[model samples]
Target chain A: MGREIKLALVYRDMWQSSGKYLPRVDQLVRVAEPIVEMGCFARVETNGGGFEQINLLFGENPNVSVRKWTQAFNDAGIQTQMLERGLNALRMSPVPADVRKMMFKLKKIQGTDISRSFDGLNNPVNLANSFKFAKEGGMIAQGALSITYSPVRSIIMSIWRINILN
Target chain B: MAGIGRPVSIGKMVKGIRERHPDIIIQYHGHSTPGFSVASSLEAARNGADIIDVGMEPLSWGTGHADLLTIHEMLRDAGFSVPDINTKAYMHVRSLTQEFVDDFLGYYINPKNRYMNSLLIGPGLPGGMMGSLMADLENNVKSVNKWLVKRDKEPITQEQLLLQLFDEVKHAWPKLGYPPLVTPFSQYVKNVSLMNAIQLIKGKERWSMIDENTWGMILGRSGQLPGELGEEIMNLAKAQEREFFTGTPQDLYPNQLDEFRQKMKDKGWDVGQDEEELFEYAMHPQQYEDYKSGKAKERFLEDLEKRKAAQQGLTSVAMPQTSNSESNVMPQSMTIDVNGEKFKVQVAYGDAVEEAKAEASKEEPKPTSSGELEEITAPLEGKFYLTKDSSEIGIKVGDKISEGDTIAYIESMKVINAVAADKSGEVVEIVARHGDDIEEDDVILLLK
Candidate 1:
């Protein structure tokens, strides 16, 4: 409980941020207490405007498995359907037709990985939005954001100087 | 002697039951009657009934029982608890034909559509008004919570506070005599006013005091729903219309109201007008009242028993073997003065509508307050069905049937939900259009 190693996590708003609408975020947030109390920190790495890919920077537990996090969120209906394109990376399924249609009209800037439901309260974005951002085909821009997810400790610690792409 | 014997006119079987068991607790079961009739459950309290029952039909579990508002009032008035468990499985069966109400009412009238009756007929736990309100609010919140779960959206400020406010208002309304039917419609309207405020929050639409709740729905009907409720109806209806009243949700709910509406709307015709009226009709006072607390129903039973004994003695002494003819009986019986004028009509009590009708035509007599009078009414809608022979030993032309049988039933929603004799007695005169709505409460048929 002391000054836990701090990690800065980032994600986009799936619904409405300031004055625009995006897509409905159906994926929920699951918590693995091993590292962070909430769960692994998932962020969308965008290329230019449209989404490119999503990276799950681990929390306190650097070796916390991807299968474990995805399965955990899936059971809670946070991360519905996902296509695992990598060990630390994942591209989620597209939004449902009904939801996508509504969000399409409602979204002002056509966003990627922005959680609009209550799940976003825990983190900045929900699991569903993260998957959707990658599902729409966003790529991992130059260097990957570095972070260490600790499942047991339940605290996500950021790592620097190790940009994989760079 | 008062004209009393009539089918569907059981003056307090509740009283009958309570007298048999003084310490017994009365229980209300699930019913199809609309909200106002459910409020009539207040009679249970007046007569000393106990415990009321209900289920979550549609809008939301534990929140959408058609009679929820009135049921809550009945609970408040009697100071009893509302039911918590559904004990019986219930689904809101809706219609979607061009005539919305026609389909809805038609389905309700059908015995087959009723899937939520006669379960858990035995004794169960008792509850109070707070529990009822709590169950309603908690269950509704749960449903809303489920819908709001995945949104990653910001929590609308003060949702908990707003819900608390709504619960308080709902609790207090019953003290005002169960809200007079039109009130919930009005209250919903007011709440929707706040619903518009949800728009001010992030991720919600911006609504004004003026865009008419979101367009493409009826509003501001003079007598139908209060104008105050117009906005709320607009607000909620806009959403529900998309979900249930007009949309195609068959893939999700095949036998639901949404599916029905989808089927009917496919015709590209409009029958929404009558559908609304049918909604009103379903809310009529039901066959029985909710059992109240204490012992009013007990005392009421004592009074009814005494009244029955006194009337019984008088009848036996005067006209023991009364003929089934209009002219064979006395003509001086005074019935209750409904509203203003003394409605002098003979009384006939019977289980069968036909037997009562026959006795009404035969031995029934004119009600002159001399224990000999009856109210007259049409037998059916088609052609006035009457006895061909004038010399029949039953009721004469001038006699009336104050209570024993059904006067007539104009068939509409398939079968006969007849307008039976309020009181069976003699026939006086019938006043009604060949094709007109049955005006029973007004006594459009003035029996002499």
Candidate 2:
């Protein structure tokens, strides 16, 4: 029982329109920025395209671990698409009590309508790799990719594997 | 435990004490016996516990292992490091402290300690946990013959085995939390005996079922087995009480029958049918059938199913219910019916209650044709929640939400996601409600 790491995801909702994907750019920033600054995790898009939007955040060792994040939400009556991620990654194992109670608090700000299971989010690893290598980067492994921080040396594991673009 | 059926937990007590006395650094140590445990003691250490109480056994999470030596060995298999164990604590103490040994004997005989009460476990012996488990396994796994015939499904995964145990232990005593009491743990071992007992030792010629040597450690080295266990199980069967194992006497393997008898006797049962009668029953196929009508088996199963169904802290009465016919035991609003079974629907607990209130206060998003602008409010306090709003595909007005759908999100930082119906017909009017900062029992979306 090292210090229990509690990850709270504040994500952006995407609207589907005219047989195409529409990203809620404003809500993404609104929900995620404050959440990230608050020392929790949130998603951020580099540019356009709903396809690339999923890569905003995750860790390196494992997936976002919705099990840890969602039980608190579920137990507290907060809704989550955490279950959907069951197919994408191993759901987070059950956390202990005090941390469970704390994660339950952080989830308060992140709770919203779950659009789908596992959130069908993208890997930020590919986004960074694509930016680093341009068009050469392609066909990323969905689960292996993640949103990694360079200075803090943190990487939010991707729910899906990814082969970095390039 | 100082006394049987008293339900003691060193883990919870240690946690409570530590929270109050974070600095009470007592020189802590621990040891597990064959039937004794370090789980409770180790749990204490993890949560500010200092000393480890050494008794007799080793460590295996799911069901538990043979004796103390076996448990420690299994800990190595599970990737846990046991660097600090004092394997010879009792041996060293025995050599050096004659006075301490005298105190221990005095303590064992004091009668005030109630230590002797723990030695009376057996068939139909009221709270004979092993007996209870046998009855449970038989009850839950209906068609024992069919199950045995087809028992080779996926082997129970280590994680699954652990989680199942956690659920059962948690169920038996709600407040016990993660590291539950030994009573429930013992039952778990007994229930999964076939799965757990057959320890696969990697390079061994074959996985071995628990034999006499192991059984000695499981019950207690000093406790009766070949004599006592045999007597207890036989007497329990004779008494027509709930029994987990049943089969043709001819089907019984040589060591199995003896092992079973010893286990029964260890709990103080009487194998009165006699060795000759047992051997006679063991060899004759037709005579065994004459005694096997199984009306008792059916009754045992019915009682067990009832217990499992009502794991939620309340004594359950066996009554079949469907969604249509309602329970009149409680008022309609106060109780909720899930498929005819009734549960008292109380207000949401902890952060959920606060989040529910916050949902009621949230601001409503701009109204659209399919998406309703009516505010979804929190019925109680809870952390605001979201159902994995993956790339937001907005909800439509015609979509109907069952009772627990994600209608809106709320959080006083511990948010609760209020699941409301998407379509209660048309969103007739908009409330500045979609994300309005709401409070207790506030109105969310009016489903008009």
Candidate 3:
């Protein structure tokens, strides 16, 4: 048999693409249940990437939302995932190392199986802490390579080195 | 991810990295800000990028990242091995996501943001700022419309204003040393540019509408800009100087975990081992406090509806009157006609004693020619401040001031507007006190 390729669906984009603000928990649950039952995907990118901000902004409990989604996905026999912005973790800016670690731990306990980590600047130094926390929390750690174009040859070379090291 | 639009450079860099680090796994994350992220992602993939980040269709273009459907099709067409994705199941997911989108659009849709724009490439607005920019633009347009109506002038189209604002942002970026357009920094740049554009259109002086946050960013408090700011910008920063940090911005933030925990505990929050709740409180102190106290959700929903109605040019009501004297005092009644639709708004004031006391505390009464004293009123509703520097006591009683001299500042809509003296006179009584919230047409001071 040919090599079977695994597909991880980023369902967060589905809501984001709609160019709308945060979707209500009930709305998310209704949409997520059917997709979770599909069973064809390797994992579903179901949380993080501003969902926490959305929850806070709309006065919703993020913990409850995460737990509900995780339980729903777990029941459907599918793993859940999140995109962790390196130092940012879940906040607007970088948090303390302890805070970031706590975030990973909480997500894992709440049922996030995979954590895709990426730095905005493509700096390996930034991604290191996230990778450590994700692994320590027993979640799949997927490192992301941030691509950008610059006319400066040295900057481009440094980016290449960072990518290689990651 | 940052800088995801330079396809050729990223491609070359990726190829070079792949040649030496053959064992390394590479995943591409690109943002579609400059309308080149998809091509850049493909370029990286062809150069041995093992994974490429993409969003689902409908959320996948314009300031969003690359589209997964487009990528999947392209990769398959190029004879590359791909996943056996359940198409039928994916469609179902799309529909479900669409329902969420529909609900969101009902409240927050900005018609201007519904299409892609070529102008964004020059200003390089981050994907994250699209919604905020649209919202700000809409609000600015409404303000401009009201101002124009008051002056018996024709209001400019929102599109024209947006284009002009874009041009201003592009102009301001270089002035601020072209800092990477991302969160916090992006918001700062957009705000500064928006204010600059609005001020220019309103025939106000430059930096007249610069806010505290933007001032902080320029002074290197938020973080270092990519390069040195212009001499003009720096001079302005000097005038409104505050203690600025040279190190990482986040280091300046005091640890608040213990303080938050104590407060939450006092509120009877049984947060034992629930790190998530703690994190919530830590991330957004005020919002989380309101939420836990059961006062945020309802207000948020009500505000959302009001905002949506305002966007639709329909009748929108303001927040209910409260007895808190600290709150900004709004007008008791006002009549506004929009497109021939008149709105009669009735505002209820709080306790008269508290209101009078708050006003009196800010300004001390001084005797003058009772009929000769000219009362200078506030031009807008905002937080009033006596001086940018706290150490220096601002204009006091009997101080001589010249016309056009800025005696105070009012912060409104995130912009700090300078309150200038309309006529030269000795200060008789300062009515609007420092840090006191004031309304439009409120007596700021009396001079003779």
Q: Score the docking of each candidate (DockQ).
A: 0.01, 0.01, 0.29
TM per candidate: 0.17, 0.18, 0.72
Which numbered prediction scores highest in lDDT against the true structure? 3
TM-score of chain A of each: 0.18, 0.22, 0.86
DockQ of 2: 0.01
Of candidate 1 chain B, the 10-residue stretch with the lowest lDDT total is B283-292
Model 3: colliding residue pairs? A17-B58, A17-B59, A148-B3
Query: Which 10-residue span in candidate 2 chain A carries the lowest summed lDDT?
Result: A54-63
The TM-score obtained for chain B by all candidates, in the order given, is: 0.20, 0.20, 0.69
User: Per-residue error at B275 for model 1, in Å?
Assistant: 16
What tens digits encode model 3's per-residue C-alpha lDDT throughout B134-234? Answer: 65565456556555544555566667787887898777877875555654456667777776777787788655656555665676654555456777787
lDDT per residue as tens, model 2, B1-448: 2111111244444455556546543222211111333454334444554332122211111111112344334444544444333435533322322332232212211111111122222211112222223223322222222222233332232223333433433232211111112221233223323222222211222212222222222233211111123343344334544333322211122233454345445646443322322221222211222223332234334543653454433324333343422333433334556679877644321112223234323434433335444444443332333332222343444554554355555432111233454444443433324423344334444444
What lDDT does candidate 2 reach at residue B250? Answer: 14
Highest DockQ against the true fold, candidate: 3
Residue-pair clashes per candidate, as listed?
A: 122, 121, 3
Q: How would you encode candidate 1's per-residue C-alpha lDDT over B6-93 as one tens digit per residue?
A: 1112114334445655665443222221122243244434454554323222211111122333454445555564433222211111
